[model samples]
Target: MRGIRSLNHLPKRCYAAARRSEALTVPLAGIKPSSATPLPPQNVQVSKLPNGLVVASLENYSPTASVGVFVRAGSRHETVENQGVSHVLRLAANLTSKGASAFKLCRGMEALGGSLSVTSSRETMVYTADCLRDNLGTLLEHLVNVTAAQEFRPWEVSDLTPRVKIDKALAQQCPQIGVIEKLHEAAYKNALSNSLYCPDYMVDHVSSDMLQSFVKDNFTTGRMALVGLGVDHSVLRQVAEGLLSERSGAGAPVAKALYRGGELRVQNNEALVHALIASEGGVTGSAEANAFTVLQRVLGAGPHVKRGSNITSKLSQGIAKATAQPFDATAFNASYSDSGLFGVYTISQADSAGEVIKAAIAQVSGVAEGTVSEADITRAKNQVKADYLMSLESSETLLEEIGAQVLATAAYQLPDSVLQAIDAVTQDDVVKAAKKFVDGKKTMASSGHLTNTPFVDEV
Candidate 1:
């Protein structure tokens, strides 16, 4: 996490300009510029290959190089029969480099002191690597090979498939996981929320052939995006072209959108009380969506951990020794291509969890009711904006943001534009967004000692 904090030493001119204007009536706390305000990304070059792949490049003066492959395939693309296939696909992707006999992609990556990994979100799968700039030649060759020359061995798949399945099964045993499953099932009903990741049954059902078929249909050059940073464009392009030149996709079509609605509750035998609530929030493009984004940051972001705050700290401390735990809450605003979800989760003493949920509900309800003051809006805005700026410290983060933003939406804008949009969000906007969320259809799911919790019955 050695992130943008290092940028504190950058020339004082940049820092000085970021200082708040003295003449403004707005408190310095409200209007102080964050790192995101001053730095605009240098120009990004975008081009398309004849085969339909997109290549986007940005140069960072940072010494490390980062590369990523983003594909438009995730669990949303899974069918009931193939529910966990995407997860399997992500796992299988790693084994390709491990199996590469001819070029030994993994060995080459390691030689460059680099690491490669693949991760998935609700809509896309991302394969990424970071290395020293000098090793770009060998690293690119190996990177392309892993995606292009994937050779799934019978033994490897058999071993890996079971291991992942077992791990997922074990994870589900946790009360937190059960609560999440219940929440999604409640909020999204049978739709994409329920399908964020494949269930264990689907994982067990996935065969090696199904995985290969998924790869064939989804890992298309036509649907792929290549993102690179801190490396020469020509060298990266040459490497990408050489490996991908002859490769042609079977051209799988994009998946359909699914939005089933309902509520789910999992009653578990445990001492901890857990409750969750999720509701409809707008997506990235809507004005309401922007308002919701700022509101979430204002309400949830903290000087503590990513999900830490005085509320969580106080709740945990109060219930630390009680039969019911003090309340621990996590509020999330998840965005997707077509829709989004806003959620609040809590864990508290079996008896007090209900009160905790009430407090949280009351808190958000006030936001909905337009009770948040200018000071609340200002602090939340500043903290949210500051967090965004602090996150841009590394080339990898910037690289990931660019590639994911493109895959999520084909259009890309500077971080400054996003910051400006956030800055422009007014108190009225956040309250309006909150009202929409509370009044709209939402879902709730939970597990572990929640049978008697009030949120379970809230509606």
Candidate 2:
């Protein structure tokens, strides 16, 4: 009552002032302001070491950095006697370098809160590390030393067999991967057909000495590249030069990838048949290669949209209408240095496999006969551009792109430039790329229930 009387006694000006000042206001000094304009994307800089090593780096203000070494040595370069050497190297070399205990190396990396991994593909082997900005030098030194000072021990190789066996087993279990491997085997007679995964027989036979020879022969400066993302180019170049040893001479020439497509069928207990039907696509970095990529997008692997069917692809949509059993078609255009495979991989119940395969082949044939619409080409270009841009968002992916570009082609492609190239593609270009793929002999491989999977002649 006393407070109410005091308020009533206040002057009109004072009451108005109190009411106006009563609204709550927050202090904003603790908040960070967002800029109206975004900073421009950083550029990738390339430099070659005096010893023929190529180093590429992109500088950014990211808290984490990626350091990777990419070499043009993978299964495709393996000899018949040393089939799984690259896969073995992926497990062994990084662990047991000379005078370095696998335990200590692993513990040290863990202490630094870093991660290391090795990946081998058909045409490239990459060892990459992700660490903090402050640990750049340590990561670089560790990478170079582990690769350079490696003595592939017999015990180390033997000890790592269980992990290697697990990888092989997992690949076998995934029908998709198994079918693709068989497809490559059927497509290429010798070189490009090299298996990416180790068979059980090859795993035990691959010796430490063989892996060492592979490292010595193929880890040459000319065929190797050091790539860093979110790091200084000059620093990466200096560290790479200071640590990277000189090479004697070039290694044996990698075999040329020839596409002599044929047929392969593996019988399995899987309920559905998995099939891969492919033909020659273009080499990497070619305009036609880009077109095939766009063509692939137009035809589309699985739909970009999640967990649903997209009837946009003529082949896939046609495949659905042709068969009642559950069937799926995913377009793939895998490109290597000299050659590539462009086709669709499908899965379906045995009863529907033949019809789906026929529909898939007709789709490829249809593309050659100018079946792609202009709007389809535009949408595919947009998807391709979007995917490429999304890749740029990751340091690891950007590192792969830059390093692969440098080591494979000695060229760099800005994201804008790649997007522009995709934009320039016409319906006719996509058709031409498709026709080029079909010009070569066709390769077909099937797994699971092989009863309805057609032979090459039927396809």
In model 1, how large is the Cα lDDT of residue 344?
70
lDDT of each residue in 386-422, candidate 2, tens digit only: 8899997877788888988999766687877887887
Clash pairs (backbone) in predicted model 2: 301-331
**Best of the candidates, lDDT:** 2
Off by over 4 Å in 1: 1-42, 97-99, 173-178, 189-191, 194-198, 239-242, 245-251, 302-309, 312-326, 455-459
lDDT of 1 by residue, 177-228 (tens): 6666555555553335545555756655677777767777777777777888
Residue 366 of candidate 2: its Cα lDDT? Answer: 82
The local distance difference test score of each candidate is 0.68, 0.81
lDDT of candidate 1 at residue 26, scale 0 to 100: 44
User: Which one is best on TM-score?
Assistant: 2
**lDDT (C-alpha) at residue 249 in model 2:** 47
Stretches of candidate 2 exceeding 4 Å from the true structure = 1-41, 324-326
TM-score of each: 0.81, 0.90
